[model samples]
Target chain A: MEHSGKPNKIRLSTNPTNEALSKLKIGDIVYLDGVVYTGREGVYMRAIEDGEPIPMDLPAESAANFHCSPAAVQNEDGSFNMGAVTATASFRFSKWIGAWFKMSGAKLILGKGGMSPEDYKKHFVPNGAIYLTTVGYGTGALLGRGVKQVRALHWRKELGLAQAIWVIEVENFGPFIVESDLEGNSLFERENAKIAENLSKAYEGTRPAVLKRFGETDDRKDELI
Target chain B: MISIDLIQQTAETLMDKAAIEIPDDYLDGLKKTASQEDGDLSSFVLQAMLENYQAAKEDRRAMCGDTGCPRWYVKMGNEAQIEGGAIALEAALRRATANATNGVPLRPNRVHPLWRTDHDNNVGIGAPEIEYGFEPGGDWVDLITVHKGGLFGTDYRMLFPSDGIEGIKRFYLDCLVAFGKRGLACQPAIIGIGLGGSKDTCMVLGKRAACLRVVGDKNPDPKIAALEDEFKELGNSIGMGAMGFVGKSMVIDCNIEVGYCHTGGMQMSVHAFCLSSRRAVARVFGDGRVEYRTDPDWFTDYQRRDTVEWNIPENQTKSA
Candidate 1:
C-alpha cells in the first residue's frame, strides 16, 4: 500500500500492474486507482478467436477490461458523451475471458453474475487474471461518473454502444469484489460451502424449533408464518 | 378522452425515467437494509450503492448501465376513454421505446431469442409486456414499468390442497437456497411467493410479486404477511449478504400473491428480485393530465391481512 488508508476503502496507489496484483489475494478489498478499458460481449472473441486486432490504443501494455455498454450521445461537435457503463454476466463470454486476460496481459476482468467454476480452476489462475463482480443493473449510469472521457472505435455504429469497443479513461475506479483470483480461489465456491454447511445445521433442528429460532420475535405464536 | 399524444408522452416519460429514477420504496428499503448490515464489507457495499444512487440522481444518468429490457404493467379503469382507440397505447409505447433507444437512451437489449439478431431497439414480439387490469370506476389509466434486468430464477411446484403453509415455505427456501446464495442473484433482495393457482398462473403471480410489489409491503392475507416478515431473518439466516460479500441480511423483503385454482390441485412458486428494484408508475387521466408515481401501492390493489409485530434489529446476528 502506498499510503495508510481506511479499512473500508483500500486504495491501490499504483496502477494494476501484474506484479502489483500478484500480491493481491482473493477477498482483499481494494479500489483500482488507475485506468481500465471497456470492452464488449465480443471484444475478447474477436481479438483472440477471430484473430482480429484489439481496437483500443491501450495507455499501458497490461490492462483491465470491464464488460461495459455505455450509453453514448453525439454532441454537435461529434464527440460522444458517455453515460453509464456497468458489469454484465460473464458466462456468455467465459470462453474468451482467459484468452483476453493472457493476450491483453490483463490483471482484472469486471462484470456481473458469475462465470463457470471450471474456467476459474482452468484459466484464471494460470493467466494471473482475477474476476471481480461489480454493482450492475440499475447503477450503470452512476458508474459513468468514473469515466473522464470515452472514445468509441471500430464498429462503433454497427455494434452501437453495447457491443462497440471503447477506450475509457478512469481514475480511482471500482468497489468491485474479488470473486475469483489468480491464486485459483473462487469466492463463489467458498461462500457456497459455508451456506451449505449452515443450511445443513439449520435443517437438523425440529420444525417447530427452527420456526422458534426465527419466529421468536413474532407475537402471534399460533400463526403459520 | 386521453389523447394518443398523451399516451405517447406518458410512455416516453416512463421509458426514460423508469431506468433513471430509483423508486421511493426501493430507496427506503436500501436505507433499512444498510442500517442493518452486519459486516464491514457488506456494509461498505451498501454505502457505495447509496452513493451511486445519489450520483445517478444528480447526474440524471442511469444508476446501473445494464438497464436491462423494459416491461410495463398497465392497469386501466373500465370507464376510461382514449383517442385513436385502445391500440394507441401500444403505438405510444413503441414510439416512446424508439425515442428512448435513440435519445434519452436505453441499452438496445432486445435480441432474437435463438439467433441473437439484436434489433438495437428495446422492443420485439412479446415484449414491453403490457398486462391490463381494470378498476370499477375511473376515467384514468395507470402504467407501471419495471426496467427488468436479467432474471435469476423462477420456480413452481404442485402441492396438494392439504399441503398447507409448511410445504409452501419449504419450496421457497429450497429455491432461494439453490439459486440465490451466489452473488449472481445479488443480496438483500426481495422474495415473492405465489400460492393456490395452476402451475403457470402461480409462476406468473410469483413474478408479479417479485418484480411489481413494493419492497417491504405486507401481503393482505394475514398468514402470508406473517411469513413475509419472517423471511428477512430466515433469508439472512442462510447468510448471503449484499452482492454475496458475506453477512446476515440476504433478503430484505418478501411479497406473496395468491389465486384460486380448480379443486384438483394447488400450485406454488417463488421468484426473486435483485436489490436494484427498478420500478415506477405513471398515470394519464381522460382530461389529459399526466402524473408520475414513485410509490406503486401494488398490495393495496389486492386484499391480504395480517396482524403480526416483529421488530428484529437489522444488525442482529441470526442465531438459534
Candidate 2:
C-alpha cells in the first residue's frame, strides 16, 4: 500500500519528451504546461471516420488530446467564452483511441475515468502515450484557472461548440493523476484488486435478486467496461 | 401574485448558483468523509476537491464543466399564483435555461438523443425537465434547480417481496461495486434508493432522493431511517473511495424513499448524486419577496402521507 502522505507531483510540458514520459508511474500527480486540445467522439468521428483534413499540427503544436466537452460558447464577435473545462470518461472512446494516437501523435490523453488495462497495453503502450485522469472528476474550475488564453477553436460551425476542438495555452493546468504509465500499469486496476478483497464481508447475509438479467455477470470483479 | 419577471430572473440566478456553488450540507459531509479517509491516493483526491470548490467560488466559474442536465423541482402552495399563469411560468423557465446555458457557459449537454444535434443552448424538446409538487396552503412558490450529472451511477430492478431486505442490500452493493470500480459514480456520493413504486416513478423517487434531499437528513419513518443509516455504513464499508481507491469514503450519505407498489413486486432503483451535487433553491412569495436557500426541504409530511386524506395538524397549518 502506498503511504498516506502526498503523492509525488511533477510538471511536464504537454509535448513531453520520452525521458519525462518514462519517469511517470501509476498514482503520480501531474500538471501540464503548454498547449492541449479537446477531442472526443465528434472530433474523432469527423477526423478519422469522415476523412476530414486535420486542422492543427500534430505533436508539434500539442500532444495532449483531452477527451472533453467543455462548458463554452462562441460569441457573436467570433471570440469564445470558455468556462469550467473538465474531462469526459475516456473508457467510452476506446475504439477511436488507437487511430487517434496514430493520426494525432498525442503523447498524453487526459480525461475523467481511465481506460481499461487492455487499452493501455494495446493503444497507449504502442503509441508512447499515457492516461492522466482529472482529479475529483469535477475539478473544472481549478483546471479552468490554468488556461492563460484560448489560442484557437475549430469546428464550432461543423461539430458544435461542445464537441469542437478547443486549443488553449495553459500553465500549471491540472491536478491529474497518472492513471496509466508508459509500461501499461494501471492505478485504478491495482486499487480495484485491493478493494475486491473485502467484497464478501460487505455482501454477507445479502440475498441475490430472484430474477436475473440476460447477460449480467455475478462476478463482482468483472468491470462493466 | 408572484412577478413573472422575478421568476425568470431568480431561475437564471439559480442556474448559475447551482452550477458554481457546492451546497454547504454536501461540502460539510465531504469534509468529514475526507478527514476519515486513509488511502493515500483517495486522501489526495479529496483534498484536491476541497481546494477545487474554493477555486470555483472564488473565480465564479461552474464547479464542473459537464454542468449536468439542468432540471426544475417546483413546489407551490394552494393559493400561490403567478403574474402570468403556469404557461407563462414554463416559458420563463425555458428562456432562463437557454440564457444561462450561454451566460454561465454551461455545457450544452441536452442533445438530440439520436440525431446528435445541438442547439448550443440547453433548451430542447422535453429538455430541462420541470416536475411539480404542491403543499397544503400559503401563497408562495419554490423554484429549485438541480444540475445533476446525467450519466452512470443510476440503476433499477424489480424484486419480489420474498427477496426482502436482503435482496435490497444485495442490489445496493451490486450498484456500488459495479459503478464504484472506476469511480464512475464519482463517490463519496449521496446514494438514493427507491424501494417501491412503479418503474418510472421508482426512477423519479430515487433521483429525487439523491438530488432533492440534503446530506444528513433522515426519513421520517424510524425503520426506513435506520435502514438508511445501515445502508450508508454498508456503502462506505465497501472499501472504496474516490476514483475507486482503497479507502472508506465511498458514500457520504444514503437516502431511501418509497411508494406503494404492485403487490407482486418491490421495484427498486438506485441513484448516485455525484461529487458535484449541484442544487439551489429559492422561494418566491406573493408579496414580491424571494428567499434563497440550499435545502430543498422537499419531502414534507404531506408529501409522504400514507392516509387517504391529508388532515392538517394544528401546529403545522400554513397561513391562508
Task: Provide the lDDT at B50 for model 2.
Answer: 94
lDDT for each of the candidates? Answer: 0.67, 0.92
For candidate 1, the per-residue lDDT at B7 reads 86
- Model 1 lDDT tens row, B1-320: 88888788788788778777777777888788889866655676777778888887788777777776788777776678878776877778777776776665567777777766666677788777777676545688887878766556456777765555655656666666655645556556777778777888788788888887877677766876887887656777766576655566667687878888879666878776766667878888988888888665555432232335433335432520
TM-score of chain A of 2: 0.97
**Could you tell me every candidate's TM-score relative to the true structure?**
0.85, 0.99
* Model 1 chain B: ten consecutive residues of lowest lDDT: B301-310
Q: Just chain B of model 1: what TM-score?
A: 0.89
> Per-residue alpha-carbon lDDT of model 1 for A111-219, expressed as tens digits?
7755767887787778767777775334565568777776444565655556777666665566666677767777666666655555644333212212223323322
Best by DockQ: 2
